[model samples]
Target: MSNKRRRSIFEIFEEYFENLEKWTERFREALIEKPSWDHRACTMEPLSNIMVTPTEVIVTSDLPYAEENTIHVKPVSEDTIEILAKMKRKIRLDDFGITHYKGGFQTLRCQIRIPVSVDIDKMEVRFKRGIFEIRLPRKQERDI
Candidate 1:
């Protein structure tokens, strides 16, 4: 490939400003738009490549395409629960060489219904990157 002509300073500035404005709009929309909850799964399934330990039930999900910070875990009921996560990143447009960053947010909502009811107040949820670990205490059967 031979060398090409250079772009003017004004052109560069224009493109930068355009992309900047686009990102600003996205952020504003995300903030102002009323959040509509979307359930990704009716129930949470066992992770394909995660470890579950004793004393607590550990569930790790591979969410490479999601943002770790947006992950939210809530106990819907005694045994049933839910997980929600989203991922965002800056990507280049294939058609236009424009550097507008499109959000790659992903929401994985899983409803977990265990064999026994869980105490939502004592539930613990920890998230790092796309991996989420939910530690839940095992329920003991009471004398009838």
Candidate 2:
């Protein structure tokens, strides 16, 4: 007999949902071409990325000139987290020669959705060299 492993139906279902969630996130991002800066809020959406590993989901963002003490990462829901940080100095659009938009900003804000189940209580955060990192341990699955 050929040696091959078979997956259980529950495993298959779990995989399907995980893939669907990931695809949904990708599709939403691809469909929405939002500006990086919000003039009314005076906030900039910094560059961010998410990575899922077998043990944890890690999210990282680039927040240059951000004041470390003013950074906050809070879980707004089971699968959503909000990140906000205030910069040390205001950034004027005119400084970049954008005369049409006259505004100064000094904050960075972003909301992220975790693709997999994670233990938010055990989440860890670190900011260094203008890079912010968040690590949330994956919740252990209990067998049915």
Which model scores highest in lDDT?
Answer: 2
lDDT of 2 by residue, 1-144 (tens): 978789899999999999999999999999877888998999999999999999999999999889999999998987899999999999989989999977889999999999999988899999988999999999998879
Judged by TM-score, which candidate is best?
Answer: 2
Error of 1 at 22 (Å): 54
Q: Write the per-residue lDDT of candidate 1 for residues 1-144, one digit (tens) a residue.
A: 859879999999999999999999999998956423222322223232323344456556655555666777776776666776654542223223534533222345556555544445676777676577776765555759
Once model 1 is optimally superposed onto the true structure by TM-score, how far is the C-alpha of residue 69 displaced, in angstroms?
2.1
- Backbone clash total, candidate 1: 6
Which pairs in model 2 have colliding backbones? none
* TM per prediction: 0.45, 0.77
